[model samples]
Target: MKLKFLFFAISFLTAIHVFSQNTYVFLGSYNKNKEAESIQVFQLDTLNGKLTKITAAKNVINPSYLTVSPNGKYVYACTETKTPNDGNVSSFEFNPENKSLTFLNKQKSGGENPVYVSVHKSGKWLVNANYTEGSVSVHPLLENGKIDSLAQNFQYSDGSINKERQTRSHVHSAVFSPQFDYLFLPDLGADKIRCYGFDETKKQPLTETKNPFTKTDLEAGPRHFTFHPNQKFGYCIEEMAGAISVYQYENGALQKIQRINTHSDKIKEGFESSDIHISPDGKFLYATNRGKENNIAIFSIDENGLLTNIGYQSTLGKHPRIFALDESGKFLIATNVISGNVIVFKRNQITGLLKKVGKEVKMENVSCVQIKKI
Candidate 1:
């Protein structure tokens, strides 16, 4: 009887391995010239957390931010260039079965240095942020996933402080609300989280009262923002301030509720940070700290939707510019840009801690990480 039970257990484990969908991770590559960069994909085993190379690094300029379409049939990214002289966005149709990517086309983002790109919930609009040009651009979609004509573009002239970093309005990120009614554009240089009512094709500015959106602290320089699954609370990661701020969002406006530092109050030196994400379970929040201190800050979201920094783990690599968690919440991956590698980590859901696993995977100038199911 004992022998038969052991055999059954082994059979179940093997079955689990065979049926579980492969976790796919994409690493954005930069060759330092902002040209000739590429996107690499890896297949992660759900049972053992093993990552296997699916797609080798292919030359595609500044595919920094990528999004797999709603149907998972295509992958889109920012080419971060206009053409001969301006900036634009690129869309690529992907074949998961063969693990190959085909170039679709490019559309002008209407601004320079397009750093952040996101597909709208409706799957009809692709929004982009021009970091250096301090503007926002929107592109329409086509049936074949090719980039269509430019739908709209907006630029704000105001800028914030930190003369060196915030000399001009640098819009770092643009995202949509849960209702798909408004767009959240975080301008690091402008010291504002501007709001716009998004329509089918164009978005208009929201009136102050009938909205749940408002600007943040003038000098905070917000880089990324994530909404609570409930859509009641939100968090914004401030790159310049090295902190995270919580807000209560309703209707279409945002009200600051709390602000917490992502680092320990130790000896002070400037530490630039990047990338912030909430776990799928919505129980934990994580942010990557760059500069001399390359670490991942772990925080717990309270009942009131405020974030309290619990601890931080060193990335075990360099310049962890971006990180992503597996779909099942079993593992996490962080991309080290300057070190030219990607590190895998096992996540403890109970404590919200990260543990290093296996070896540091080699890559080149990896800037972003995106995890999806096979």
Candidate 2:
């Protein structure tokens, strides 16, 4: 009887592993002058948190930021450029059958140094944010998974308190609201979160909303923004100040509710916050901080959307530019740009803590990480 019971338990666990969906992860790197493949694809074993290389997408110039379509059939990247008004965005067809990417076409990004790109939920519009010139560009997605000409290009002129980093407007990210009715442009150099109404049904998809925009602290340098799963609150991670600002969002407007630091007071100087994300369950939030304190700050979100600091974990590498959690919320991957390595961590689901899984991949200046079920 005991032998039969043990056999049944092993069979049950094996069935669960076989039924789980296979996960695919894409890594983007800062490949200057096309020295290496800009994007690399890997397969992640959900049961054991193992990452195996699958393939790579080559010849993409500085494809620093990547976003997939709603259907996951296409992939888009921001081709970070140096020349003013010369940045471009590229589109690729993702072949799931063989796990390969084929280049489709590219479009001008309106401004230089395109740092961020996001696809609209409808999969009809692609929004890009240019950092060097502080501009936002919108493009229509063609039916063939390519990009149309620039639909709108809005330039910002204001500068904030930080003279070195905020000499002029520096639009960092373009994120859509929960319902897709509004878009938020976080400007690091202007100290403002610009809001706009989106209507893809019209000739022009984006228009300035009635509320216009909202302001952050004098030198907050709002870099990235994320909305809660409940859609009642929003959070902005400040790049220059190493802080997270909470807001009550409604009808394209933001009301600042609370602000919390991503790092402790002991490490006062040289704080450069990079990215922020919420867990799949929406109970936990994570933000990355660079500089002397190279770690990820973890927090728990209360019922009212307020945050309570929990703990911090070392990234096991330098300059963790960005990190993302898998769909199952079982694993987390971080791209260490300065160290040129990608590290994976196993997540404790109930306690919301991270443990290094002893897996790392060496690449050239890794910058971004994206995981999707294939």
Candidate 3:
């Protein structure tokens, strides 16, 4: 009887360990064919970096980007991308028990080609950046995970040095500050990082801060902005120049502190840097470069929030548009848009490097990858 009780205790502990190592990976893709699936859900094995398909959500056209709510109960996606004068932001209920997504409702995005969406930590607000129409929209999230109509809209008309790519304002990403009191929008075309104060209690929660914008270098084309884990610094990846601009962040204002190139000296032209993410422990940073240089640049952060480029890892696929690290910080997954595949990597926590692992998941034109622990 004693031995049987001991075995039962050990088995219970083992079951809990296995359940803790599972995470959900969400992939958003561009539906070139109208009947194709737009969003997919996969179960990621955090222990080995393996992915098993759970299900896919269809009927939404061009769900290019996705973001999960703070509670992990809902997912929001930007749909109908590149549709002239018509773009929408859709919401879905995420059921972790069954591992499926149910379509809730969608609202007009207030502009064309909504490329990015971010939810506030309170799960009360949702904001999106419109790439083609050069606008920003704010929405109130209902209690049932439905998105309210657009509460506020802002438009910008500005251009930078690049005549072709920077001819007009192209807001690429909308990110919330660590404190959840501000929102930052990285404008690729205007070469500026726009800031706004956020107050969740009010009807219109977005207000202009004292220092509204931080200007970038000429032709830099800032694409994505990510805050450091310590909340003392922020990093922006430039799409056109293949560089990262580091900033000292305080109360919605950004002061540039360091500027670093993400590529080697041998590569000269065709730099299309896409995504930026920092490790959970605040020790390392990683950025993805597309176009001619298809690699992920690895960097180490110091005590003063400065980045020192350590090395680069080939993505093993072409056109890595976005990559995400799981909540455990042990697995990193990247989506190759043009290559039509998803690659998983084993992350080294101490050295801050990535090793390709597991089999590649095939999904045509996958644009964004996000992981959430449920």
Candidate 4:
């Protein structure tokens, strides 16, 4: 009777887990590059969704930003450095067995201080943004995780209004349009996003008569951006101006629609915009602000690919530069660089609000967050 009771209890819990579903989350680590505290993986389970520790703490250095191949086979992390010691992107073959990242070759980001990294939709190319040098580059992808070659490196020299930050152009972020037909690069110092025409056969951005699709505000210092999944529009977050600009991008050109403040009427003295991301479902957009105010400005994207402000929420930490929404879209992981922690917040998909879930995962001066699963 005792043996039967124990067996029944185990069976009941196992059945419950099976019904709940399986989910895993991987977190990047940031420290002063002592012994590499590899990217941390967690298990998350909740009514909103399921979560848990998929991989134990494995070792990787300053896995500051993460991107997975569209096919989900390859994972990439940007080292986020300026000096020759660390300015490179590393590729990984994820082993779900132990949640460990197998070593892959490093492709030197010819441009210094590369901050943002992304895999093009076709998985044929990889791109990097040089935050300090104000340059961008594209590299060809190989059948293996290694980069076949870095095909192009383009530098920006334009200067804008802001004297302090605009002393030199800084290409802060680079992203390809949903169709992978255009590349949008936000140069914070230059206060412009230079659009380039994409050519798959040539493997480069072209300067056509219809190209150089330029957009900006009066020294707005555009920092980061995201496109509406529908591909009808795009949005930009400006750090100097502290506002979000909505645009109509159709056919092959872009037209500015709206640019609205991320703050309330009461403007603080020192607030800089950091990151912007559109939710997976295409209903909500989020941008993080840092400085005197650290919060995420939320907006409701309409059917026409325009934006309406929902409001802002304190990220519950300091210097909320970059963040990530879990695959389930139930959690927003906010990385507070100054606070030295990454806090998880439960996101209400319907209401577009975030509430802190638990204590933050301690890190050291983290600059970005990328959430992946096993």
For each of the candidates, the C-alpha root-mean-square deviation to the true structure, in angstroms, is 5.5, 5.3, 3.7, 6.5
**Model 3 lDDT per residue over 160-249, tens place:** 888988889999999999999989999998999998999999999999899788999989999999999889999999988899999998
Where model 4 places Cα greater than 4 Å from the true spot, the runs are: 1-24, 46-61, 84-86, 203-209
The CA lDDT at 224 in model 1 is: 90
Per-model TM-score on C-alpha atoms: 0.89, 0.93, 0.94, 0.86
Model 2 steric clash pairs: none
Residue 203 deviation, candidate 2, in Å?
Answer: 2.1
Which prediction has more favorable TM-score, 1 or 3? 3
Give the winner by lDDT: 3
Q: How close is candidate 1 to the true structure, as a TM-score?
A: 0.89
TM-score of 2: 0.93
Residue 80 displacement in candidate 2 (angstroms): 3.3
What lDDT, from 0 to 1, does candidate 1 have?
0.78
lDDT assessment of candidate 3: 0.91
Which ranges of candidate 2 are over 4 A from the true structure? 1-21, 82-85
Please give the CA lDDT of all the candidate structures.
0.78, 0.89, 0.91, 0.75
lDDT of 1 by residue, 186-255 (tens): 8899778878777764443332235523677767889898888778987888888888889898866888
Q: Write the per-residue lDDT of candidate 2 for residues 1-374, one digit (tens) a residue.
A: 99999999999998886576477888887887565788988889887788898888887778888887887788898886554457899999887678788889999999999998999988899999999999999999998999999989999999888878898999999999999989999999999999999997977888878887899998999999999989999999998999999999888989989999998778888889999998988899999999998899999999899999999999988999989999888899998989899889998988889998857899898899888885
